[model samples]
Target: MAMAVAAGCGGGSDSGDGDTVKIGLLASLSGTYEAVGTEQRKGFELYLDTHDNKLGGQKVELSVGDEGDGPPTAVPAATKLVKKDKVDVLTGIVANGSYKAVLPLVEQAKIPLVSSNGRPEVKNVDRLWHTAFLSDEPGAAIAEHVKEEVDGPVYAIGPDYQGGYDELRGFTETFKKAGGKLANPDGKTKWTPFPKTTNFMPYFADIAKSGAKAVYCFYAGKAAIDFAKQYAQSDVADLPLYTAFVTEGSVLPAQGKAAKGIYSVLNYSADLDNEANRKFVADWSAKHDTPPTTYAMASYDAASVLDKAIAEASKGGKEVTPDTINKAIDGLGKIESPRGSWEFGKTHSPVQKWYLRQVRPDGKQLANVMVQDLATLGD
Candidate 1:
C-alpha cells in the first residue's frame, strides 16, 4: 500500500550558499497513500512558490521521502533523510502507520516530525509532533450531531488500527457521553485489518448480520470508495452510513453516487463557506489536477507552518535545528488557515476546529460539503 525510499542525509536545500535552509518532506509519494501524497507534494510546492522559498532571507530545500505502503518503507526512508541526507526538519505523512513506524527513528536521531495525518495517540509518542488534528476521532467532532439526529442503534466498522480506533472511539465516546450508545462501543469494532484483504465481501456480509441500524466508519484511500460501493450493493446500504475522515475529496469522487447522502466528520470541506476557504479551493484546484480535500488542506497547513517557522527562525539564526524551527512554527500562532484558525499543541498536534461533512453530487462530480463545525475533539 505504501513504498519507501531510504535516503541518506547529505545536504540541506540551501547548502549554506546564500541563506537557504534544508528540510525533509516525508510522505507516501508512492504505494497506498499515493493519492494523498501527490496532492500534499503539490501543496507543499505551492507553499514554497507562494512564499518565494526565501523565508527570512534563507532558501528552504525539501528532501522528499516516500513512506511506501506503511512503516517498513517509512522507517528506512526517514533514516535516510536524517542520517544520510542531513535534513533539519522532517514533516508530512499521509498514513498513520508510517507515522508510527518512523517516529522512533526520528526521536532517536532527535529530528522533528510534523505530521499531516491525525493519529491522536501520536501525541503520546516522542518526536512525533502533530501539526494536523487527530481527525480519526469521530465522536469529538460529530458525535453530538449523530446522537441528536441519528436516533437508534448504531453499528461501527472501522480500520481496526490506531487511526481507525481513534475515530471510532471519538464517535462512540462522544455519543455515549451525550447519553447514547453505539451497538458495541466496548466490543471490537467491525472492520477489516488494512492488510487482511483485497476484497470486502466477507466484511459486507458480516455487516449485514450485525443488527445495526446505522453504521459509522473511518476508512480512507481505496478502502473508503470500496466500502461505500460494497455497502450500496449489500444489505448495509439499506441503513444510513456515517463515517469520519472517509467521505472527502479523493474518496468521495471515487465513490460516485454510491456515496451520496452519507455523513462524515472532518476538519475541512471543499465547499466550506468563507473567503479564505473559497480562495483556497479556487487556488488549489487551479494549481492541481484533482479536487481539493481536507488532506490537501491540512498537508498544506503543515508546509505553511514550516515556511512560517523557517522565516522566523532565520530572524536571528543560521543553521536551522528541528527544535528551534518547531518553536518558530508553534509561535507563528494563528496564520490564516484555509479551514479558518489553527493552533499547534505542545505535542505537535493541533487544537483546531472540525466539521461534519456529507457527500453530495454537483451534477456528475462528487464533493464533501460542510454540515457542521466541530471544535477540537479534546478535553
Candidate 2:
C-alpha cells in the first residue's frame, strides 16, 4: 500500500561503478508482515553499519521498497526497483508469494536476488539465492524428532497458502515415511483459510476430536500471536505443540505465557552457544531492546553473502556486475553467520544445521531456548 525509498550518494545505474554498489531491498513494510519487514531491514542495516556501509570493499547505496503482502503490491514495487532504481542486486522479500511474483522480473533483468526469508520450490535458481531455508526445511528437519517423541498420531495444520502447503507436506511426508501417522480425519493436514481465518477455535476443537497426541503447525506475525493466545484457552491447550515460525522472537514476547512450553524448529536462536552468535547477539542488543529473530539473522547473512560475493566479483579489475556477483556467490565456500557456518546448496538455499528449541523463561522474560541440534538439512 505504501512505498518508501531511501537513496545514498551514488548513481542509480547497474554499471558496476567502482565507487558504490546499489542494492534494492523489497520487503513487506506495510500490511500483515510489517513486523518481519522491520526486522529484515534492521538486520541488513546492522551489517552495513558494522562494515562501514560497504560491501565487497565498495560503498553501498540501498534502495528500499515495500512489498506489502502479496503479488499485487510486490510486483509494482519490484518493477520500480529494477526499472527505475537500476539496482545491481536485490534482497529482502518476506513472503513467499512476493518472492514468486518478482522472480521473473529479476531473472529477466539478470540481477541476483539474495532473499532473506522462506521461498517456494523453483527450478531456475541461477540468479536466486536465499539466506533463509526452503519453506519445508524446518518441518522436515523436526519431523523424525516429533515422530519419536510422541506416542500417537500428530495433527498437522497451517494457513491455506503455498508456504503452508510446503511446510505441512514436509512434516507429513517425512513423518509417514518414518512410520508415523496423522490424526486428522482421513489422514489429511488441516488448512485454515489464511490471513482471513483469525479465529482458530474451530481448528483446535477439531484437533481435540481427532485423538492426536501432538500438534504441528506454522504461522507467523499476527496470525502466530493469535494462534498461540487462543490455543492457550482452547480445550486442547494441554496437548504438546510442535511448530516452526509460530514461536519466533518477533511474536514470542507478544504471545507471552501462552507460548511457553511450545517446541519449535529453526536454523537460528539467540541462545545458540557459538562465537558468531555471541558477537551477533551483543551487537544486536546494543541497538535493539528485543532479541533478534531468525528474520533478522537471515537478512544479516544475506549481507554477509553479498559482502563476499561483491569482493570476489571485483577481483582482478572485473566490474562488480550482477552476472559476476551471481558467479561469485556460487564459489563462496562457507558463510560465517549468526546461525553458524553454512554454504549455498544446489537449491540456492542454505545447507545448514537445524536446532530444536523450546519456549522457556529467560530470567524474567520468555525466550526460545536452544535445546539441541536436531539435524543437518538442505538440498
Candidate 3:
C-alpha cells in the first residue's frame, strides 16, 4: 500500500531548516490493528488538509510508517523515521508495546513524540506527550459508575498485553475501592491471549458460571468485532455489558446489532454538542459514511497541538526546532478540540472529561450516543 504524504511548499529538505516541519506518523497500517491505524492516519491528514498542509505557519512534510502489531515491526519503522527520515516530531502508535519500543529512539533523537494513541506508563516522560488517554484512565473513569449501575459483581476481561493489564487493573482496583466485587472465581481479571484468541466461547461460558451481574472488557479492531458478535450469541447475552474500546466507531459497523445498548466510557463521541465537535463531525461526515472514532479524534488533536506549539515556537524569531517545539507544547494552555477544550496536565496527557456513551440508533445508523458526563480525569 502506498503511504500518504502531504508535501510542503518548498523542495524536500531536513526539518532543521526553517522551510518545513517533518512529522513521522508510525502506526499499524497492516496486521491486526490496521483499522485503527487507518483512522489515525485519516485523522491527522484531515487536520493537515484543513490547515493547508501547514503547522506553525510553515509547510509540513509528513512521513507515514507502519508500526504493524508489536515491537519487532515497530522498532525498525521507528528507527527509519527517527534516523533516516529525520522527523522533527513523531506520532501515531496503536499498541502499547510499540509505544514502549520506540522510546529509546525518541530520547536519543531528542524529538518530541505527540502520540495519537497507546499511552503507556514510563518513568521518563520529559519528551513524551499523548493525545490519547492513559490506558488506565478509561477504566478508572467509569469504575465507580459501573459499580453503581450494576447490582452485583462484574466480570472483567481483556486481551493479554500491557494495555490490557493497565485497563483491567484500573477497573478492578477502582471498583474494589468503590465497594464493588468481581465475579471471577480467582478474583482476578481474565486475560485472553492477544491476537490468538479468536474464539471467545470458552470465555463466555466461564463468565456464565462466574455469576456476574455484568461484564466489562477492553478490546479493539478485529478482536472487538469477534468478541462483541460472540458475546451477543452467548448464554449470558442478557447480562449488561460495560466496556471502554469495544464499541467504538471503528468496529461498530462490523459489530452491528451485537454492539447495541452496550455502555462505554471514552473522551469523545460524534454526537457531542459543541461548536468544535459539530464542525468536526460535519467535516468527517462529508467525507465518510460512518461517524468518527476516538482513534481519529485523538490523532486529529495531535495535529492541533503541533499547530499551536509550532506557531508558539516560531514567535519572536525563535527557531522551530524540536526542543523549542517541545517547550512550546509545555506552555500551551486550553486547547480547543473536537472532544472539547482541554489542556495538557503534568503527565503531558490531556486532562479531560470522560463521558458515558451507549450504542444506540441514530436515524438508521448506530452510534455511540453521548449518555452523560462521567467525570473530569487525567491528573
- lDDT for model 1 comes to 0.68
The CA lDDT of each predicted structure is 0.68, 0.88, 0.88
Every model's TM-score? 0.88, 0.95, 0.96
Clashing pairs in 3: none
- What's the C-alpha lDDT at position 180 in model 2? 95
List model 1 lDDT by residue over 192-217, tens digit each: 77755457777767767766678777
Q: List candidate 3 segments past 4 Å from native.
A: 1-18
Q: Tell me the TM-score of model 2.
A: 0.95
Which model is ahead, 1 or 3, in terms of TM-score? 3
RMSD of 3: 2.1
lDDT of 2 by residue, 1-379 (tens): 1122232223335443335578999998888888889899989988888887788777787889999988999999999999987888899998888888899999888889999999999998988999998998899999999989999999999999888898889889999999999999989899999789899999999899999999999998899999999999999999999999999867888998999999999999898878988988999999999999999999999999999988888888666677888888999988888898999999999999999999999999999999999999986
Off by over 4 Å in 2: 1-18
Report lDDT (Cα) of residue 234, candidate 3.
99
Worst 10 residues of 1 by lDDT: 1-10
Best by TM-score: 3
TM-score of 3: 0.96
Q: Could you tell me the lDDT of residue 57 within candidate 1?
A: 49
The per-residue C-alpha lDDT of model 1 at residue 238 equals 79
